[model samples]
Target: MNIQDLRYFHELVNLKSYTKTAEKFGVSQPTITAAVKRLENKLGTTFLIRDQSHKSIIITRVGMQFDEHVQSILNELRIAEEEIKQNESATIPFGLPPIIGRNYFPTLVPTLLDKGILHRLNVIENGSYDLYHLLLDGHINFSMLGLTKVNPEPGIRLKIIKHYPMNIIVSKKHPLAHKKAISFKEIANENFIGLSSDYIHTRALDRMLKQSKISINTIYRSPDVMVVKSLVAQNLGISYLTTLSITKHDDVVSIPLLDANQPEFILAAATRENHIMTAKEEELWDILTK
Candidate 1:
């Protein structure tokens, strides 16, 4: 019925032995047994059945179902604790992916600095895929996520702010460098340097390949955009990247994809569903979205 009883029961189910559960919780075996009995009596169900030897326990059907609820309850409690502590700190937990941080975030920096909220931001830099998970887990208050498409997810809200085209990047000396635009079919045989699967760029690339009915020979994969660009610049292999990561100073050419239905790198502002924005958070969000 209580949190401790649930914790003990959950651990007992996992460990499959009362003595082991007691050892894990640093409690006497009787205490663990008592907790389990209390839960069964409150719920009016036999969660587990112990054999005569008592070496192992068999979890009843109800026990398995109760464990699922216990996990959800525990997880929610933990997230609530984290959210409370974070709110007390008065620092906004912001998520910023690397590509957007480099190309787009600067435009809003002046506004944030003028409003005196720049120092209050706790920026967590990661790939957009990872950032989305962080937002879902309540680890971050908000994020600018790079996505291939806006899909519905539970406990999360997404709004598309901008869209950037994905392009084929090549070294200046590469054969396709002179071409302004190229289709996926034209480079089907080319050696590709792709971003890691954790990136939306990789997802876009996979979709393109599937649509074009062609497979590419990927020579290497990197999570860092800089490393991918460096390899492409060396003519090691061509790469598919979003224009957001490309700059005028980079020694590479961004050739637009000529595919009729090319996928775009989507920039979306995401936050937890029904999240109430604090005053400072609202100010910062307005600046970011503006």
Candidate 2:
């Protein structure tokens, strides 16, 4: 079957109107009708049936099933086109989440500069959740993803760089700050500050709470880690964060959770499984994986 026929048929299924599909594709109504007929003939099944007035159509069960495949096919083609374009471009589209970019990514910059690939980077900074989707959709070439756990996805390759324990952070003056470690039960009813849902910390926090059967009052949420740290430093509320974000310069104390099985914050480098890296991209990937 012709590729154009697949496009026409896909849109026809979505719009459910021959005139609208034809208008959208800038083709005649007969062309749309012929495309559908060609696909049905090739498949050896009746995909659709038009009413006597030819003004409406009823998609057969086979048609719906085929439409699902068509959607996947079209999406793959779109990603293929984007990947080809990315290969042709001189600059690499790199994704970095804010937390990783701020705390972890700087460690790689010196090596990147030494390798002379730093100038070729076109960075897209966002939360890990958004960066993961962007990399999967072919909007970015590679991403340094921060996640609560290793989530396996088809057509994506992930290399675990490091794992840091998620820790509880509180102001120096807080009652629990002097403790070496604490359990979720000790602070279950305390006021809490938390990162926004976009961050992986939120997922780890939620899972910890659920597993421990504990709940706390979250007084504030911020996408900025600094804001969360500031709130915690002022003794307004306690927060959870990864160890990578903690430093001697910060006023807050990082205390480990005493849970038997605490979730870890994972740092990973992600790229499309099918992507053929250019020489420069390969060098960058090597440095990252190292």
Instruction: Find the candidate with the highest TM-score and give its number.
Output: 2
Global Cα lDDT for candidate 1: 0.88
Global lDDT of each model? 0.88, 0.91
lDDT of 2 by residue, 133-208 (tens): 9988888889999887787689889999999999999999999999999998888888999999988889888889
Candidate 2, which ten residues in sequence have the lowest lDDT sum?
48-57
The clash count of every prediction, one per candidate, is 0, 0
Model 2 alpha-carbon drift over 4 Å, by segment:
none
- The residue pairs that clash in candidate 2, if any, are none
Q: Any runs in candidate 1 off by more than 4 Å, and if so which?
A: 274-276
Task: Give the C-alpha miss distance for residue 63 in model 1, angstroms.
Answer: 1.7
TM-score of 1: 0.92
